[model samples]
Every structure is written in structure tokens, then in C-alpha cells.
Target chain A: MRSDLVDHVMTVFGAVVRGLVYSMLALPAILVVASSFTSSDTMSFPPTGLSLRWYKKAFDSEVFMSALWTSTYVAVLVSIIALAIGFAAAFAINRFSFRGKMFLQGLAFSPLIVPAVVLGIGLLQLFAWLDLTQTIYPLLLGHLVLAIPYVVRTVLASLSLHDQMLEQAAMNLRATPVQVIRRITLPLILPGLLSAAIFAFVTSFGNVTVSAFLTYGGNVTLPVQIFTYVNTSYDPVAAAVSTLMIIVTLAVILTVERLIGAERLA
Target chain B: MKQSVLNRRNVSVAVLLAPMVLLLTCFLVVPVLGLLRSSFLPGSEFLAGNGFSLTQYVRFFSDSYYSSVLMETFVDGLIVSVVCLVIGFPTGYSLARLSPSARRWRTMIVILPLTLSLVVVVFGWLIILGRNGLINSLFVRIGVFSSPKTLLFNRVAVTVVLVQQFLPFMILSVMSVVTQIHPVLEQAAANLRANRFATFRRVIVPLAMPGVLVGFNLVFVLSISAFITPRLIGGARVAMLGSLIYERIMSELNWPSGAAMAFVLFVSGLGFTAALNALAGSHLITKGRGNAL
Candidate 1:
């Protein structure tokens, strides 16, 4: 009876500690979102009366607006291109036993292991030598390299979980290879494809290190802009922008959760 | 007929892989090679004129300032990794123990922070840790402190934010492996007259070492290479190797020196990853019953 009480107390202690740790994980974002609604000019938590002035300020600024636009289009393009390349590589890897398959797989996932700072400097130097540093190509290409690994990983997971016997059964029904892929394989892996695309999108969208190096004049990404802004300024406007970013990320996450479930993505 | 079929298969495979290979070669491989080449060049050349020299690398090694930065970067990585493991092990164990539906929502909470941009997350930290921010104001109001302390721009703040940022990766890694450990083993251990702690220490921890090592490797690599968090929170006061490299390349316009340092960082990261893998192979494989990894 005494040992049972001790076990119960231990369980309660463990639960309380776990609860605090999870709260600590969540506290920063919650603080940022709460502080964004401050009525005063200075950013504060337990905000000094709620207001939307900061959000209005963020929206009104041309720098913030243009950066948002740049980030959106760059992310969209990167996601599409990454999906195309990742899908092909993932499919080839999953479906066939080719020579250098291990090497190819390693190369595909190599970007994840390399530090973003290293990749950023390398691309910057390469673009400077090629005299293409002035254009938006560096930013697009840098983000593409960073984003592809996520797409490949997600698509590969999706493809591996897929069964090939269905494709075989489709072939036995007199379907052409293309028809088999289109009719059976594509629909089944659509969730994975969508998940991969979303992963690509968020990676490209949230990138700061590579974008910092590659973003040329008039082409700064939202995250880079916010990074620069917060370094110099301590205003609620930055908080407001951060809140919006959080909302967008949360929205994307929710959509994926609804479509495929977050557990599967993990 | 067999020859034609074999040729056709090879051709299709090559065609499918072509675009990805081309992209990686052009952007990833060529640029990295270019960086490696420049790292061997004289600092005065600015990546255009090429005279091969190890001056940049020698400068990095000889300069106490640069070497300390490198050391500090590794130390910071180690600190973050250790803390993440300590906190994440329990969270991940509990997560693994949950029902499927319960686990899903808890997993969502963990995943949410990861999806937010690093800049946004750091900004959130700034609000909380800034002078007159949440902690200070609350403490002062409740008479815990006399005034608002300088909470931002320090090693502690940087470490705290990094732990928050990377904890999810560690948790997810641990949970993935923990979920794979059969419940029957725990039952068997209990049936053999083992207590809960004994079961956890002997059965669960050994089984979970592979995941723990993987998580440690990942968090260490990421924390050392981290740029924005250290730069924002630690500022110039506690600059890591990443912030130093950024300053050299961006502010000073010293490509060769920056490239050399970047190369050093890459090699060290790779070295640590390999060392950990070897450690897992030699130790875990011999002792553990199955290859958990």
C-alpha cells in the first residue's frame, strides 16, 4: 500500500515535469502572438491593452509588403520545382534497382547534412564569379537546393509505404505502364505528394541563412527582412509580422494534418 | 530480346535521374567545389584571381580568436544536444506510450513550432526575454527582483531559444524509436520481478540508444551551424563560428578566409557524425540484441 502511494506520487511528478517542458516548448510563440496586440508603441507582454495597430503598421509598410510577395512567389516556384525533381528521383529509387543507387540517394539527401552557412557562402561565391549576383536566380537556386531534400525525404517515405502489387495487378488488367501509374499509383500517393510539396513550401518560405546570402537588391525574403528588422528595431510591428508568419505556418500545418495526418508526416 | 529490354530499362532510369542530377551538379556540387578551391586561394584574390595557397587555413589555425570561436561553437552544440536529450527523453517516452489519437495531437503541438520560421521563433523569444518583458515584469511585480535584468544578448538566452527550436527534432527522433520497442518486453521485464525504473534502465534505455545517438548527432550538427539564433540572441557578445563566418564573408568581404572557415566547420560536422556512427556500431551492436537503428 505504501509502495503504491509512492508510485502514484512519482507518476504525478513525472506528469507535472512533462507538462512544464511542453509549455516551455510552446511559450515563445505564444508570447510573440500575445505581445503583437499591444496598444502602446513599445512591445510588451501581458500587453498594455489590446489593439491591432501593429498589424496595420506591418501591412502599411512597403518594405514588409514587397518582402512578403518575394517570399511567397519564391516559395511557390521552389516547391513546384523540388516536387518535380524529388518525385522523379524518389520514384526511380523506390521502383528500380539501378547502379549507383546508394550514391544517388546519398547525393539527394546530402544538402540536409551540409550546414546552410556553408552552402550559402558557396553559392554566393559561385554567383559572384558568374556575375549573376545581381539577379534573383541565386536566391531561387539556393532555396531550391535547400528545399529539395525535404521533398525527397517525404516523397521517399510515401513511396516506400506504398505497395507495388497494386501496380502489378493494374498491369495484369491490360493497363499500359503510363495508365497504371496514372490510374492507380498517382491517386494513392497524392497525400504524400501534397505533404512533400507543403514541406518544400515551408522550407523555402522559412529559409533565412541561404536567402541572406543570395537575396540581391530589392529581392529580400520575409524572414530575412524580419531578421534584419529585429536586429535594429524593437517594435510591435516586428511582433505583428511574426504573428502573421506563425498563423500562416500553423494554417499550412493544419491543412496537412487534415489531409494526411501529422503522424504520417513525422 | 533480353538485350533490348535491358538497354531500354537503363535508358529510362538515366532519363528519370537526369534532371535531379543536373540540378545538384550545377548548383550544389559545382559551387561547393568552387568554395573549396577558393579556400586554397590567396585572400587578396577575391575569388577571381587564382593563386593556390593555404594562407587562409593557416590564418584560421594560428589565430587564437578564430580557434576559440570554433571551440565555442562545438561546446555550444554539445550543451544544446545534452539538454535536449535530458528533456526530450521523458517527453518522447510518454508520447510513445500514448494512444494513437492522443499521440497525434501531442505530436501536432511539437510539430507546430518546427514549422514556424526561425526568425519568428527568435522574435518570440526576444519579447519574453527582453528587458521589461514577461519574466522580468512578472518577477518584479511579485517582488522577486528589484528591477528588470538584461535577459537578452547572452549565452543563456541563446541556449534557451536553441533548445526550444531543436527540441522537437530530438523528441520526434526518440519517439520514433521508442514506439518500435515492443510492449511485451516491458511486460516480460516486469514479470521477471523488475521494477519500473529497472525496466526503463536495462531494457528501454539500451533499446533506445540508437535513437538517442541519432538525435544527439542531428541536434549537435544543427546547433553548431545555427546562424540566426546566436546572432539575434547572443549578438556580438557570444558569436559562434557561424556568426564569425557571416561577418567575414558579408561584412569584411573576405571570401577566402570565410570559405576556409566554412570548410573547417563542414569537416568537423562530418567528423563528429562519423565518430558517433562508429561509436553506435561498436558499442550498441555488440551489446544490444537487435540492430535498433
Candidate 2:
């Protein structure tokens, strides 16, 4: 009898642990993804019925489209800007040892440790002062602040691995500084540059913390759109939108991985 | 063969850094300066000073309500990070032990969470944790409980969401640090007749503390400033620092107070991280010197 009781107790405790872990990992489907499958007039769990209506509804929604475009455009620009700035800094930091190298390194990597919301507040206050918060430019600029760190680290890793001896040999052969750069350094680090650009793209593309407080109506990113939607209503439409986000993001990540072999670049 | 080219190439370093210098100043340095200056701007009250004023600090630190909220925020942060470490450490160790190519693919999967927006995750949790959600339905079907438990807009929900969301990052950071520690350290301990528990506590734990510190700092900083997850999961019941700052600025229309709060948040986050980084750097420096012999 005691053994039976012990077995029962063990089974119950085991289930609890299983339930919690399962919910932790699998709840995304229950909460976000599965809800997209409701065949009802309102959001229901186990989705009362399965249909594609809400997905269609989300697609027809104008606000969702606007926010999607906003995020795409902002992410594209932020990636480009972060790549340029980080490329410059990485080139300088790796190619030559300077007096302020440590300080500059810290300055570049500072945002990696700072919280996004804090960064957002500071950027919002600064941009508001400059009367620029309402526009998409501030949104891009705010993302650039955060995205540059990724670019710097990625490019720096590649640059350090690059063969300085080859560049020196090129110079020995009478190649100009420009020629050496074009033939040697840039080609070697292009993979890193590409990886950095992808990282920047994804970071900016998915960011909501810095983008949230900084975003105004015209500057509403996709995440902001999802936020407002979830806040105001409860429905499978959110699930549909989330499904959309997941698909697009998965595609982008895979493409980036293929281009640079995500592991090597990271 | 070309010494003259070396001189010009050295000069080219300045050209490479110039644009970056300008960007860093505008995007980073200048904003911090602006935030600091705005923190001291005059309030409409009697107490106003240029040098130092506790108007904002005093208000937040004095009130028991905000103080409780602050304590809760830190506790939640600690819990989230520690929970991540517990799950992430094993996963990280496993990933580290994998062959290089396999490790790469595993890392890609682990980091997929990071590459997407947090908004999706929060929204995802809501459906799953809701009263009529999967867990509840499963419980009812199995006769575990007649009524579905309320998991939404609660502390448990908040912590769960944060942990699931940030687990990948904790794993990545811990894996990076653990990858550096030779597995032979643990093996040696095991060979010396130490049980797994002893080996873990004495050997694994000490080596992994650096990553633990880093992961803890990041998760803490992130948890402190997080507005949306708690907003979505915990609702208005939980007053975290992130929402407080938002309310102070947007609702109260107090920009100076908002700036002060933001500065405090910024400094505290940076300050603690700097302290941790200093410890890690000094450790590395000492190890470097020891290796020179």
C-alpha cells in the first residue's frame, strides 16, 4: 500500500514538472500560433473551429500593412547605416593600434550592455528635443545606435583573422593603399560584412523596446502594430499576424544562414 | 619592398575611423550628455538646484509603493536570470560538447529566438497561458481541476515569459565561457574519486561563474527596463521601472523627472556591468601574466 502511495505521489509530481516545462516550451503554439486557427467569431482556445478567416482579416487590415512596411524600411536603413559606421570603426581598430583604442572599443560596445528601454528613453528625449521623434528617421537612428555593436564585433572577428602579411606583400609589390584594400582586406572580410549586415537587419527588424517608446504613428513598426493589436483586442488575428512574422523571420534567418553559414559568421 | 606605402597606409587608419568617430559622438556620446543635462532641469516646485537635487531620486526612493515595486523588479530579474542559468547551463554544456559543425546548427536554433521580435513571444504566451488555453483544456480533459487556473497577468506568468524569451541569450553567453574551460578539468575531478555533484560544485561552478555573472547582469538589466512583457503578461497590477518611466513622461508630463529616472536606470545598468567586466578583465590579465612564464 505504501509503495502504491509512493508511486502515485511520484507520478503526480512528475506530471507537474512535465506540465510546466511543456507549457514553457510549447505554450507559444497554444497562446500565439494556435490561436490563429480559430473558426469562431472571437478568439477561443483549442480554437473552437479551424479556419483561415482571421489570417485573411489580418491581411486586409491597413494598420498592419503600414506597420509592416515601416519596420521593413527602418530595418533596411538601420542595417546599412550600422554596417557603414561599424565597418569604419572595425577597419581603424583592427588595422592600426591607436592611443584611444581601448576607450573607442568601450564606446562602441557600450550599447551591448545598456538596456533597450533605457536607450529608448534617452533617444526619445534627445530626439524630442531635436523635434525628430515623430519621423521614421529617429527610429532608424535609434536602432543604429544598438545595431552598430553587432556589426563591430562581427567585422572585428573577421579582420583579426585576416592575413596582414598578404597585405604587406601586396604593398611590397607596389600596390597602392587603395589597391591593397580592394584586393586583400575587403574581399577577406566580405563574409563578415555580410554577416554583420544580416545581424543588423534582424536586430533592427525585430526590436520593439527601443522602437516602442520612440515610435509615433508614422513610425509604427511591425512589433508596435502587434502590441497595439494585442492590447486592444483578443483574437486569432494576432495569431495570424504572429504566424506571418514567424514565417518571414524564419525565411530571413535561413537566407542569412545560407549566405554566411550563420555559425561561422557569428 | 615598399616602406613608403606603409607610412601612407598608417595614415589611412585615421580616414577609416573619422566617420565612425562622428557617428559614435552623435549617436552615443551626445545623447548621454543630453540625458544628464535634462535630469537637473527645474521642477515647478520650491526645490530647484543646478548642482544636485534629489527631487526625482527622493520621490522614487522614498515612497514605499515604488520601493516595493523596485524590490520586486530586482527579485524578478534575479529569478528570471537564475532560472535561465539552471536550464541554460545544461543546454549550454551540451552544445559546447557537440562537434563543431553540429554545435553550429544547434546554436542557430538556439539563437532563432533572438533574431525575432519579443512582441511575438509575448503574444504567443498570452494564448497559451490564457484560461481557455491549451494547458487549461488539457487539465480539464484529464480531470486535474474543474476550473482553469488563472495564469495571465500574474507574477508567475511574467517570470515564465521572461525566462523563455531570454533563455537563448543566457545559453549563448554561458556556452561561450564554458567552451573556454577545458572539459578535462571536470574529467580530472571525476578521476580523483569526486562524485558528479562534487565535481560540478567545485570544478564546473567556479569556472562558469564568469558567464553566470555576465548572464545575471544582462538578464537583470534587461528585466529592469522591460516594459512590454510585464505590461502584456502582468498587466497594470505590476509597476516595473520601465512602465514607471513611461508613465512619468507620458502621463505625468514631467520630463525632468523622467530624465532623472532614465539616468538612474542607465547608470545602474552600466555601472554594475562595468564592475563585472572589470573583474573579468583583471582575471584575464592575471592569467595572461601567469602564462608568460
Q: Which candidate number maximizes DockQ?
A: 1
Q: After superposing candidate 1, which stretches have Cα over 4 Å from the reference?
A: A1-13, B289-293
Give the Å error, residue A182, model 1: 0.7
Residue-wise lDDT of candidate 1 within A71-103, one digit each (tens)?
999999999999999898888888889889999
TM-score per prediction, in order, is 0.96, 0.87
- Over the stretch B1-293, how does candidate 1's per-residue lDDT look in tens digits? 99999898888888878888888899999988988998998854665667889999998999999889899899889999999998888888889889988887788889877888989988888888888698889998999989888898888889888998999888988998999999999999878877777677889988898899878888998999998999999988998999998888888888888899999999998898899789877877677755333
Model 2 TM: 0.87
Tell me the interface RMSD of model 1, in angstroms.
1.8
Prediction 1 global C-alpha lDDT: 0.87
What's model 1's lDDT at B112?
A: 79
